[model samples]
Target: MTKPLIEITNINKSYQNGDQELRVLKDISLTIDEGEFVAIMGPSGSGKSTLMNIIGLLDKPTSGNYDLEGQEVDSLGDQELAKVRNQQIGFVFQQFFLLAKLNALQNVELPLIYAGVSPSKRRELSKQYLEKVELVERMHHLPSELSGGQKQRVAIARALVNSPAIILADEPTGALDTKTGAQIMDLLTDLNREGKTIIMVTHEPEIAAYATRQIVLRDGVITEDTRKGGEI
Candidate 1:
C-alpha cells in the first residue's frame, strides 16, 4: 500500500514562558494523503498556527512523531529539516512575504536559486509557475506595484515554483477583500483539483469551506475533524 504524504502522531508542542510551561498543542494525530485539501481552523490561541508550523517543518513538536513521505522527521537536524522543507513543502503566508524589491518573476525564482538550479532553468520554471497562477503578464511588477490579490498570486507562483509535494498556506485570504479572497480561493481550488496537496490555516468558515476537509482545534486539542461529505 502507498503511504500517506504526511503522517503526524501524538504531537505535542509547548513553550516556556517565565518559568511556566505553556502547552500549545496536545496529543494530536492526523494523516494527510497526497492531493487532499485540508483546512485547519481555530479561534485565536487554539494552537492551529502551532500545528501548521509543525506540519510545515518551521517548528518541531515538543514530543511526538512526524513522518513526511514515510520518513521520520522529528529527529532531523535543522539543516536536514531545512533541506527537506525546501524539497517537499512550499509555504504561502497571509502577508504574501514577497520581497518588496524583487519583481514577481524574481520572487518566484527565489526558491530555485536556493535549490541551486541553473539561472536559465530558474527563469524558465518561474515563468511557467507565474503562467499557472495567471500572473505572467505582471511578471515584471514589484510588490508595491501590484494589488493585494496580485501579490498573493505571486506568492502562490513562488510556492509552486519548487514543485513541492505539499503547499502550506497560512491565512492566505486574510489580507484581501471578499471578492479578491474568493478569486484566490478559486485559484487554490483549481490547483487542488490538479492534484496538489494543500494544507491551509484559516479562521473564516467561508474560507475553510474551500477545502475538502476541515479540522477544528480548540484549547490545544482537535475538537472536530470533518470531510465535506461526512465525518472521516
Candidate 2:
C-alpha cells in the first residue's frame, strides 16, 4: 500500500482558561493520502481548526503522534518543526492575511526570505507563482487596492510560492460572496487536479462538496468519513 502523505494518531489537545480546562480535541486520528482533496466540516468549537493546526505543524498536540511524509513530527524540536512547516505546508486563511503595506510580489516573497532564498531567486520564483494564479499584472498592487477576488488570488499565489506538499485552508471562502467563492473553489479544484493535496476546514456543505473526501468532526472526534466515486 502507498503510504499516506499526512498522518495523525490519537491526537489530543486542551487549553486552560483561567481556572478551567477546556478539552478542544479528544483522541482524533486521520490520514491524508497524496493528491487528495479533503474537506473537514464541523460546527463552532468542534476542533477542526485545532486538528488543522496539528497537521500543519503550526502547533503541537497535547498528546499522541503525528507523522508527515513518514517523519515522526511529535519528536521534532521547534527548529526542526519550523523547517518542516516552511518546506511542507502552505496555509490560506479566510482573512486573506496579506501584509497591507507590501505589494503582491513582496508578499509572495516572504516565504522564500524565511527559507534563505536570495533576492534574485525570490523575485523569479514569486513571479512564476503569481502568473500561475493569473496575478502577474497586479504584482505591484497592495492588498487594499485589490478587489475581494483579486486579493484572494494573491493569497493563493503566496500559498503556492513554496511548492508545498499540502495546502491547508481555514474557511477559505468565509469572507467572500457566493460568486467569488465559487471562483475560488474552482481554482482550488483545478489545483487539486494537478496533484496538490488540499485539506480545507469549512462549515458549508456546498464548499465541502468540492473535495473528493469529507470528514465530519463533532465534539473533537471524527463522526464520519465519506468519499466520492472512484475514491477509496
Candidate 3:
C-alpha cells in the first residue's frame, strides 16, 4: 500500500481569548493517502477548520504530531514551516481570495513569486495551469471581469500552479450558486481523478458525496469516519 501523504497522530489545538482558554481540537488522529479525496464535515465551531489549518501548516498545534510525507512537521519553526507550506500545500477558499489588482495569470503566479522563482518561469507555469482549468483565454482578465465560476476556476488553477502534494479547500463552494458550485465540484473531482490528493471542508452532504471518504467532527473531536468503495 502507498504511504499516507498526510498524518496526524493524537493532535490537539487551542486558543486563548482574553485570558479564556478555549480548546478547539481534541486528540484527533487521521491519515490522508495520496490521491485520496476526502471531505471533513462539521457544523460551525467544530475543529474541522482548525484541522484544515494544521494540515495546511498555517497554524501550529498545541500538542501531538503532524507528519507530512514521512517527516515530522508539528515541531518545525515558523520559517521552515513557511517553506514547507510554500512548496508542499495548496489552498483554495470560499472567498476566491484573489487580488483585485491582478489578472488571473498574475494571481496564479503569486505563489511562485513568494517562492522566489524567476519571472519568466512563473509566467510559463501560471499559464500552464490556467490552461488546465480551461481558463487560457481569460488569463489576462481581472477578478472583477470573471464570473463567479470563472473566478473559482482561476482559484483552482492557482492552487494547482504550485503542484503541491495536497490541496486544502475550505468551503470552496460556499460563495457560488447551486449550478456553479456543481461545476466547481466537477472540476475538483476531475483533479482528484487525475491523482491530486484533495481534502475539503464542507457542511453539505451532497457536496461531500463527491469525495471518496468522509470524516465528521463535533465538539472539537472526530465523531465518524466513512469510506466509499469502488469509485469517487
Winner of 1 and 2 under TM-score:
1
lDDT comparing candidate 2 with the true structure: 0.91
TM-score of each: 0.98, 0.96, 0.96
- Candidate 2 stretches with Cα past 4 Å from truth are 230-232
lDDT of 3 by residue, 1-232 (tens): 8679988999989899998989999999998899999999999999899999989988889999989999999568889999888888989999999999999999999999999999999999999999998999999999999999999999999889889989999999999999999999999999999999999999999999999999999999998888896422
lDDT of 1 at 161: 89
lDDT of 1 at 52: 96
lDDT per residue, candidate 2, 121-232, as tens digits?
Answer: 9999999999998889999999898988888888888888999999999999999999999999999999999999999999999999999999989999898888997434
Lowest lDDT 10-residue stretch of candidate 2: 223-232
For each candidate, how many residue pairs have backbone atoms clashing (under 3 Å)?
0, 0, 0
Model 1 weakest 10-residue run by lDDT: 1-10
Question: Which of the predicted structures, 1 or 3, would earn the higher lDDT when compared with the native?
Answer: 1
**Candidate number with the higher TM-score (1 or 3):** 1
Q: Could you give candidate 1's per-residue lDDT for residues 58-165 as a string of tens digits? A: 888999999999899976888889888887899999999999999999999998988999999999999999999899999999999999999999999999888899
- How far does residue 185 in candidate 2 sit from its true spot (Å)? 0.6
